[model samples]
Target: MEFDYVIVGGGSAGCVMAARLAENPRLKICLVEAGGSGRQLAIRMPLGVAGTVPAFPFFRFANWAYETEPQAGLNGRRGYQPRGRCLGGSSAINAMLYTRGHPSDYDGWAARGCTGWGWEDVLPWFRFSERNERGTDAYHGFSGVLQVGDQKQPRSMSKAFIAAAREAGYPLNDDFNGRVQEGVGLYQVTQFFDGKKRGERCSVAAAYLHPRLDWPNLHVITHAHATRILFENSRATGLEFRRNGTNRIVKARAEVILCAGVFGSPQLLKLSGIGPADELSRHGIPVLSNVPQVGENLQDHVDFVMNFRTSSTESVGYGFRGGWRLATEAVKWWRTGEGLCATPAAEAGGFLKSHPELDVPDLQLHFTVGIVDDHSRKFHPGYGYSAHVCVLRPHSRGSVMLGSADAADAPRIDPRFLSDERDALTLIRGAEILQTIMRASTMAPYDKGEIHGQDRMRGAELMDAIRSRADTIYHPVGTCRMGSDAVSVVDPMLRLRGAENVRIVDASVMPSLIGGNTNAPTVMIAEKIAGEMKYNL
Candidate 1:
C-alpha cells in the first residue's frame, strides 16, 4: 500500500494529523493502530473509566501495561506504566481532565533552546484545537474539533474538597485553564456536551477521526502493529508492520510520522537502527543515524497519595451502600447526563508551591472522592477518599532502551522515579501539605483519620513511605525531546534530526514535562504541526 503520509499509531496525535491533513482532497493519509477498534462502548461512557482504566482485566487489555525495570530510587520497586492502546490512545482511557499545563512550561522549553515553543507561540495552537463549552476567548476556540467542558455535576465530596482547600487558605479559582492556575476548583473534562454525543468522553478519535471518517483521502487501519520504519539511505520511506498474523509493508510518498507516543516512538526508532551507536551495536542492528538522544531523558510526575477514611457514603469506594448508590447514579447518567458517573474520580485539584519562596507552584494535587490503591487494583471497604501530591517538575531523568531486537517485545523502561534527592524532598513536603488540607475545618466533618501513612512517620520514615508507595501519575514525556541542541532527537520543527521525511508529534517530543496534564498540550502539538504541514504542502 502507498499513501502521501503513513501515520503510525492512531492515538491522540495521529487522529488529529489524519483529520487535518485529509482536508486537502488530493492528499492521501493512512492511520495505523496496533489495538482493537476504537469504538468500544465502555471507552465512550464516562463512568466506564472505573472499569476500563482501573480494573485489571480491562486495564491490561486496553493499555500497553508496560512496567519499568526495578528502580533503586523507589527501594527496588517496578513502576507501573500504562499507555493507551486504542485509537484515541491514553486520551480514551484517561481521567478526561483537560489541562493545558502552565504557560511558563512552554516558555521554559523555548528558553532551553526550543525555538517557537514559547507560551505565546503555542497558546494559539491550544486555542485552535479546543471547542470549550465555556465559550471562546483569546485563550480558547469555539469551532475546534475537540470538546472541552465542565464536569456534569461534581459529587458532594468533590464540592467538599473545594471548600476544604479554601479553608486551608487556598484560593478558589473556577477556571484553572484561565489567567491563573494557583487555586482549587472542579476540573474541566474533555467530554462532549452537545449533539448526539452529549456527556460522552470526547476522545481524540471521537472528536477528530470518527467525525472525518467519510473523507476519501483518509484511511484508518486498526490492529496494525508497526514493527519498524523502512528507511532508505537515512530517509524514512515506508513502514513494515504485522496485521492479523501477516506481515505488510506500506510506502509513504511524503512523510512517515510517528505518533506512537513516548515509549513506542523511541522503541520503534531504536528497533529500526536509529538510536545510540553503542546500543545498536550491542543488538547487532546496522546503525542508521546513531542518534544518542532517541530514548534518553525520560521524565514522569511521581505521585504519593494520602488516603483517609470518610464517614460519608458519598465518596467512591466498596461496600453494599456504595454499590447501590453507584447503580442508581449510573441510571441518572443514562437518563439525565448528570451524576457521579459523569465525572472522574479526580474532580478537583490544586497547584501550589512546596516552599513559599519558589517562583512557580512546585506541587500539583489531585483530589479523589475514592480510595485509589495500586491504580485501583485493590478496593478498600466502606467510605474513603484520597489526595495525591506530586512534584510538578521532577529533577530526575531515565531512559527507554531496546529490550530485544524483536519488534513484538516490550522495551526496557526505566523512569527511575524520584531518583533525585531533590524530587524526594519536594514530594515529601507536598504530602505534608495535602495532610494539612485534609485536617482543615471544612474537611473535619468527613475526615475519619489516616488510612495510608501515620503522623508519627516523620522525616526518614516519611521519606521511606514516599519511596515505598510513590508511583507514576501517568504523565510521561521527554523521551524523544524536541530542541535546537545538537543531541536533541527532534528539531524545533518536530522533524527527526538526521532522518528525512520523518516527524514526531506527541508527548515524546516535549523538551520537558509540563506543569499539568499532557493531553491538551499533546493535541496542541499536533494542531501546530498540522498547521505547519498544511502550508508546507
Candidate 2:
C-alpha cells in the first residue's frame, strides 16, 4: 500500500494533519495508530476520567503506561508517564484543559532561533483550530474543527476553590488564554457544545478524524504499531510496521511525517538509525545520521499534591455511600449529560509566579475537587480534595533513550525531577501559596486541615517531604527540540536536521516546555506545520 503522506501515530497532531491534508482529494494520506479506535464509553464520558487512572483497565488498554527510570531527584522513585496510545492520543485521557500557554512562551521560542513561532505568528493557528462556544473574538475562533467550551456543571467545591483563590489576593481572571494568565479561575476544556454533542469531549479524533473518515483520500489504520521508518539514503520513503501479529510495509510516495509524540517520535528516530552515533552503535543499529541530541533535553512539570480531608461528602471519594452516589450520577449523566460524570476532576486552576518580579507565571496550580493520591492509585475512605502545585518552567532536563534494540520495548524515560535546586525551591514557595489559599475564608468551611504534609513541617522537613512525594504532572517535551542550532534534531521548520522527506510534528519538537498543559500547544503545532506542508507542496 502507498500514499502521498504516511503519518505515524494517529494522535492529536496526526489527526489534524490527516484532516488538513485530506482537503486536497488528489493526495492520499494514511494515519497509523498503535492502539484501538478509542471508542470506549469511558473515553467519551467526561466524568469517566477517573477510570483512566494509573492501574485501571481502561488506562492500560488505551495508554502507553510508560514508567520513568528512577528519578534521583525524587529520592529514587520512578515517575509515572502515561501517554495515550489510542486515536486521539493523550487528548483521549487528559484532563481536557484547553490552555495555549503564555504569549511570551511562543515569543521565547522565536527568540531562541525557532523562527515563525512567536506569539503573533502562532496565535492565528491556535484560533484557526478552535471553534469556541463562547463566540468569536480576537483570541478565539467560532467556526473551526476543534471545540472549546466551559464546563456544563462544575462541582460546588470547584467554585469554592475559585473564591478561595480570589480571597488569597490573586485576581479573578475569567480567561487565562486571553489578555492575562496570572490569576485563578475556572478552566475552559476542549469539549464541544454543539446543539447535539453537548458536554462531549472534542478530542482530535472526534473533531477532525471521525467526521472526515469518509474522505476518499484519508485512510486510517488502527492497531498498527510503527516499527521503523524505511529510509533510502537519509530520505524517509516508507514505514515498516507490525499489525495483527504480522509484519508489513507501507510506502510513502511524497513524504513521511511523524506525529508519534515526545516518547515515540524520538524512539522511532533512534530505531531508524537517525540518533546519536554512539548509542546507535551500542545497540548494533547502523547509523544513517549522527544527531546526538535526538533524545536529550527532556523536560516536564513535576508536582506535589497537598491532600485535605473534608467533613462534607461533596468531594469525590470511594465507600459504600460514595458508590451509590456515583451510580446515581452515572445514570443522570447517561440520561441528561449533567452530573459528576460531566466534569473533569480538575474543575479550576491558576497560573502564578513564585517570584513577584517575573514577567510570566512560573508556577501552575491545579485544584482538584476529589482526593487524589498517586494519580488515584491510593484510595482514601471519606470525602476529601487536593491542591497540586508545580514549577512550570523547570530548569531540570533529562533524556529518553532506547531500552534495547527491540522496538516493542518501552523507551527509558528519565525526567530527572527536581534536578535543579531552584525548581525545588520554587515548588516549595508554590506550596506555601497553596496552603494560604486553602486556609482562606472561602475554603475555611470545607477545609478540614492538611491530610498529607501537615502544616507543621517547616523548611528542611518540608523540602524533604516535597522531594519524596513529588512526581510528574505528565507534561513531557523537548527530546527532539526544534531550533536552528547545530545540536538540535529538528530545524525551525520542524524538518529532521539530517533526514529528508521526514518531519517531526509533535511535542518533541518544542524547543522548551510551555507554562501550561501541553495538549493545546500540541494541536497548535500540528495546525501550524500542516499549513507549512501545504504551502511547500
Candidate 3:
C-alpha cells in the first residue's frame, strides 16, 4: 500500500494527524496500529478505567512491555512501565484529566530552543483542538472534536480536600488550565456528549479516528505492527510491518510520522538504524542515522502516599462493601451521569513549591477519597482518604536502549529514579508537607485516625516510611527529546536530528515533563504539530 502519509502507531498524536491532515480531502493517508480498535466498555466509563489494564485483549497488542533496569537507588526494584498498544495509545487507558500544565512549562520549552512550542505560541492550538464545556474564552474553545469539560460529578470528599489545601495556605483555583496552576481544585476532563449525556470522557480514537472511518481516502490498518522504517539515502520512504505472521511493506510518498510514544518511537528508530551507531552495530543493524541521543534524558514523577482513616461511616471503603459502593456509583452514572463513578479516583490536587525560594511549584499533591494499598487494582480495596505527594521537575535522568535488533524484542529502559540526591530530598520534603496538611484544622473534621501502620512515627521514621512506599505517578518523558542541541533526538519541529521526511509526534519529544498530568499536554503537542505540518505543506 502507498500513501501520501504513513503514520505509524494510530495513537494520540497519529489520530490527530490523520484527522487534521485528511481535512484537505485529497490526501491519501494510512494509519497503522499494532493494537486492535478500542471498543471496550471499560474505556468509555470514567470509573471503569481501572479495568482497562486487566482487559488486555481490547488493548493494543503490539505494546513492547518494557521494564526498567534494576535501580540501585530504588533498593534494586525494577519498575513496570506500561505503554499503550491500541489505537488511542495511553490516552485510552489514562485517567482523563485535561491539564495544559503551567505557562512556565512551555516558556521553558521555548527557552530550550523548541522555537514554536512556547506557551503563547502553543496556547492557540490547545484552544483550537478543544471544545471546553466551560465555554469559549481566550484560553478555551467551544468548537472542536476534543471535548474538555468540568467533572460530571464532584465527589463528596473533594470539598474537604480543597478546604484543607486552602487552610494550608494554597489558593483555590477554579481552573488549573487558566492563568495559574498552583492551587487545589477538581480537574477538567477530556469528555464529550455521548448520546445527550455529558461528561463522557472521549479518547483520541473516538474523537479523531472513529469519526472518519468512512473517508475513502484514509486507510486504517489495525493489528499491524510496524517493524522498521525503509530508508534510502537518509530519507524515509516506507516501512516493514507484520500482521498474523505475515510481513508486508507500505510505502510513504510524502512523510512518515512516528507516534509510537516515548518507548516505541525510540525502539522503532533504533530498529530502523537511526540510534547510537555503536549500539546499532552491536545489534547487527545497518546504521541509517547514527543519532546517539535517540533514547536518552528520561524523566518522570515519583509519588509517596499518606493515608488517613475517616470516621464518617459513609466513607468509601475496601472489599465486598467497596464493590457494592462502586456498583451503586456505576448505576448512578448510568442514570444521571453524576456520582462517584464520574469522578476520577483522585478528586482534588495542588501544585506547591518544596521551598519558598523556588520560582515555580515543585511538589504536587493528589487527594484521594479511597485508600490504595497498592497501585495495582488487586490490592486497592481499603476505605480511607489518602494524599499522594509527588516531586515535580525531578533532577533524576534515565535512558532507553535496544535489547536487540529484532522488532519483537523489548527495549531496555532505565529511569535511574532518585539517582540525584536532590530528587530524594524533594520527595521527603513533599511528604512532610502532606503530613502537615493532614494535621491542619480544616482536615481535622474528616480525620477518623491514621491508616498506615507507621502513622505514629515522626521525623526519621516518617521519612523512612515515605521512602519505602514511594512509587511512580506514571508520567515519563524526554527519552527521545526535541531540541536544537546535538544530544537531542528530535529538532524543534519534531524532526529527527539526522533523518529526513520523518518526525516524532508524541510524549517522547517532550524536553521536560510538565508539573502535572501529561495527557492534556500530549494532545496539545499533536494539535500544535498538525498545524505546523499543515502550514509548512
Candidate 4:
C-alpha cells in the first residue's frame, strides 16, 4: 500500500494529522492503530467511562501496557503506566479535564529553542481546534470539531472543595483554562451537552475522526501494529505493519508521522533501528541513526491522596460505596447524565506553590467524592472525601531503551521518580497544605475525622505517611524532548534531530509536564503540530 502520509498510531495526534492532511481531498493518508475503533457505548457515555478500563476490548488488549522499572527514589516501587490503544489514544480513556497549562510552560518551550512553539504561536492552534461551549473569544474558538465545555452541574463535593480552597486563602478561579491556571475551581471538560443522554459525551475520536470517516482520501486501519520504519539513505520512506496475522508494507510518499504517544512512539523508533547506538547494537539491531537522546528525559507527576470521613453524609462522597444508593445513582445516570455517572473520578482540583518563593504552582490537588485505595474501586468501598496532591514540576528524569530487537517486546522504562530531593520536599509540603485546607471554614461544616489516617500523625509521621501513599497521577512526558540541543531527540518542528522525513507529534515531545492534567495539552500539541505540518507542506 502507498499513500501521501503513513501515520502510525491513531491516537490523539495521529487523528488530528490524518484528518487535517486529508482536508485537501486529493491527498491519500493511511492511519494505522494497534487497537480497534472506540465505538463502544462505554467510551461514549460520560458515566459509562469507568467501566471501559477493565474491558479488554481495548485497554487491556491493544494497550502496550508499559510499566516503569522499580525506582530507587520511590521506595523501589514500579509504577503502572497505561497508554491508550484505540483511535483516540489516551484521550479515549483519560479524565476529560481540558487544560492548556500555564502560558509560561509554552514560553519555556520556545526559550529552549523550540521555535514557533512559544505561547503566542501555539495559542492560535489551541483556539483553532477548540469549539468552546461558552462561545468564542480571543482565546477560544467555536467553529472547531473539538468540543470544550464545563460540567452540566457541578457536584456538591466539587463545590465544597472549591469553597474550602477559597477559605484556605486560594482564589476561586472560574476558568482554569483562562488567563491563569492557578487557584481552585471546576475543570472545563471536553464534552458536549447531549439532551437525550442527560449529560455530556464527547472525545477526540468524536471530534476529529467520526466527523471525517466518510472522506475518501482518509483510510483508517485499526488493529494494524506498525513493526518497523523502512528507511532509505537515513530518510524515512515507509513502514511494515502487522494486522490479524498478516504482514504488510505501506509507503508514505510524503512523510511517516509517529503519533503512538510517549511510550509507543519511542518504542517504535528504537524498534525501527533509530535510537542509542549502544542499546540497539546490544539487541543486534543495526542502528539507522545514532541518536543517543531518542528516549531520555522521562518525567511524570506523582499524587498522594488524603482521605477524610465526613460527618455530613449528605456529601457526594456518601454514594461511593456500592449499595442501593449507588444502584439508584447509576440508574439515574443511565436515565439522565446528571448524577455520579457524569462526575469525573477526580472532580475538583487546585494549583498552588509548595514554597512561597516559587513563581509557578508546583503542586496540584484533585478532590474526589470517593475513597480510592490502590486505584481500584473493588479494593476500597466507603463514604469518604479525598484530596490527591501531586508534585507538578518534578526534577526527576528517566529513559526508554530497547528490551530487544523484537517489536513485540516492550521497551525497558525507568522513570526515576523522586530522584531529586526537591520532588520529595514538594510532596511533603503539598500534603501539609491539603491538611490545612481541610481545616478551613468551608470544610468545617462537613468535618468528621481523619479517614486516610493522616490527622493522627504530625511532623515526621506525616511525611512518612505521604511517602507510603504517593503514586503517579499518570502524566508522563519529555521522553523524546524537543529542543535545538544536540542531546535533544527532536527539534522545535518535532523532526528528529538527525533524521529526515519523520516527526513525533505526541506528549513525549513535551520538554516538561504541565502543572495539571496532560490530556488537553497533548491534544493541543497535536493541533499545533498539524498547523506546522500544513505550513511546511
Winning candidate number (lDDT): 2
Instruction: List residue ranges in candidate 2 displaced over 4 A.
Output: none
Model 1: how far residue 119 lies from native, Å: 0.8
Across 1-537, the per-residue lDDT of candidate 2 in tens digits comes to 999999999989999999999988889999999998877777777766777756487458778889999988888999888888889998888889999899999999999999999999999999999999898898999878898999888878888988998888888878989988999889999886765666677788989998889989999999999999999887899999999899899999988999998999999999999999999999999999999999999999999898888887767878998899988988887777678877888989999988789999998989887877888778788888888999899999999999988889999999988889889899899888887888888887888867775444668888888888889888999999999888889998898999899999999999999999999999999999999878878
Residue 419 miss distance in model 1 (angstroms): 1.3
TM-score of 2: 0.98
RMSD of each predicted structure: 1.4, 1.2, 2.4, 2.5
- RMSD to the native, candidate 3? 2.4
Q: Model 3, range 13-119, lDDT digits (tens) per residue?
A: 88998888887777899998998786555666666555454334443342334577987666777766766677788777766778777889899999988888888
Query: Which residue runs of candidate 3 sit more than 4 Å off their true CA positions?
Result: 53-66, 193-197, 309-317, 377-382, 444-451, 454-459
TM-score each candidate.
Answer: 0.97, 0.98, 0.94, 0.93
Supply every candidate's count of residue pairs whose N, Cα or C atoms clash at under 3 angstroms.
Answer: 0, 0, 4, 1
**Candidate 4: 10-residue stretch with minimal lDDT:** 53-62
Stretch of 10 with least lDDT, candidate 3:
54-63
Say which prediction, candidate 1 or candidate 3, comes out ahead on TM-score. Answer: 1
Candidates 1 and 4 compared: the better one by TM-score is 1
- Cα lDDT of model 4 by residue, 261-380, tens digit: 778888899888888888888888888888888888888898887776665443344344445665777677777776766766667887888877888888888886666554433334
Give the lowest summed-lDDT range of ten residues in model 2. Answer: 449-458
Best by TM-score: 2
